[model samples]
Target: MSSLVQIKDVTKTFHRGSEDVPVLSGLNLTVAKGEFLALMGPSGSGKSTLLNLIGGLDRPTKGSVSIGDDRVDQLSERALAAWRARHVGFVFQFYNLMPVLTALRNVELPLLLTHLNKAQRREHAETALKVVGLSHRLKHYPRTLSGGEQQRVGIARAIVTDPTILLCDEPTGDLDRKSGDEILTLLQTLNQEQGKTIIMVTHDPHASARATRTVHLDKGQLSTAQPE
Candidate 1:
């Protein structure tokens, strides 16, 4: 498969007071289309930072971040926002669903940024929820759901936009073993059956095992990719 995401000699730094704190330095990596890749490392290893760059959430201090044909690091702020809405979906460790919104409504949030009508958004949201096996909980609130169920809702919301890639940050970190396994299974199904390219940051070996390939990061540099 062709390379879908490329990071070339990328570096990220933050200015803390008068000090320049570097997070990533000369990092180079590539992810192919339809790949389910896992990034693992100890805390503060720049895994999440790399994910953010790939998703166009942040730019590198030096070098390039390319997703397909777009040079993400070079996009204007407004352009990057639009690009992300169309091409990237994010899942966080903590479910970011709205407390007051119904499950279906929360899944429809991404569509609101598009030109889809209310009915169209609702249809797409329902389809996404159904895919995640949460159709029965369409009217439920986030607070009413279990940790696993809420994460399912988060997965549904992430994919509702049909983005080109999924960027997951510790997606199952908050759930129990059974629930985490279920979520991992769902992700595997999505990768194998739906051909969705996934780049996930995980601390759990079990969670990383679900991916097709795994790579390690240490202090901003990546280790070689290993078959899962």
Candidate 2:
């Protein structure tokens, strides 16, 4: 597997009034194509920061972030937005579905940015929902679904566009143990069967255990010993 995502000597800092708070310090990492990577860390350890940088949701204060041949840190805001829509798919802890949209409609949101027409988008969304085993719930709203179902909907939405990589942040954080386990199984299937490169930030040991590789972060740096 070749490298698909690369981070080099990256640093991220935020300013709170007069204080400079650093999140990631001179970090370096690489993710291979079709690899499922779990990032684990305590609060304030820069796990989410690193994920955001890789997903192009945030930029590094210094150094480079490269996905494929594109230098992410160098893209203009407009270019980055366009790039993210095509190359990245995001699944948040909260299953960020719109209350008013049905499962199919929610999954079709990303397709609207592309040239696909309404009928084409609906077809694509239906296929994605079916892949997540939610074909029966296509007409249902988020409020009507269980936590696991909602997260499944979220996963469908994330994969509807067939992104280059999937970035998940605490995907099972808000679900119960059984629900979390189901979601983890779904993620594992997505990686193993569907060949999606995944970078996930998770605090649960069980969740991290499902990944191909688990790396720990503390005080803005990666631990030398990664668990496989």
Candidate 3:
């Protein structure tokens, strides 16, 4: 498979008063198409930072992040947003769904940025909800759904755009063991059946075990960049 995501000597730093604290330094890693990668670390380990960089939500203070042939770190804000819209899907610990919108409408939100018509966008959203087995709950609000259902809606929203790279931050952090397992299995199916390149951050070893590869990050540095 092709190399879908690449991190070359990537480093991130933040300024606290007069001193610059570094979280990542000279990190190099590559994730291939259809690969499921788990990022593990304790608090302040830079796992979430790495996921943000991959998703183009933040730039590395130094170094480069390349998605396919494009150097994401180098893109301008506007360009990066456009690139992300086309290539990246994001799932977070929180559902981040609009409280007023029904599940179907919430999933349809991402598609609004596209040029697709309302009908076309609805079709896409419905298909995505169906994929997560939520078609029957289309009219339900976030408060009406279970934790798993909400997360599934989040997943459906993320992939409704048909992105090549799916970046999930603490994907199962808010769910019970059974719910988390179900979410993990669903992600596994996405990688195996749909060939979406997934990079996920989690503290759970069992969750990490479900991935094709696991990367450990410590103090923002990739302690283990290669697959395990």
TM-score of each: 0.98, 0.98, 0.96
138-186 in candidate 2: lDDT tens per residue? Answer: 9999999999999999999999999999999999999999999999999
Residue 140: error of model 3 in Å?
Answer: 0.8
Q: Compare candidates 2 and 3 on lDDT and give the better one.
A: 2
lDDT of each: 0.94, 0.95, 0.91
Q: After superposition, how far is residue 5 of candidate 3 from its true place, in Å?
A: 0.8
| Tens digits of per-residue lDDT for model 3, 1-228 | 789889999999978999998988898989998999999988898888889898899999989999999999989999999999999989989878899999999999889889999999999999999988899999999999999999999999999999989999898999999999999999999999998899999999999999999989887677665435
Weakest lDDT window of 10 consecutive positions for candidate 1: 219-228
Candidate 1 lDDT, 1-228, residue by residue in tens: 999999999999989999998999999999999999999998999999999999999899999999999999999999999999999999999988899999999999999999999999999999999999998999999999999999999999999999999999999999999999999999999999999999999999899989999999988888875425
Best by lDDT: 2
Model 3: residues >4 Å from true position, as ranges? 225-228
Number of backbone-clashing residue pairs for each candidate, in the order shown: 0, 0, 1
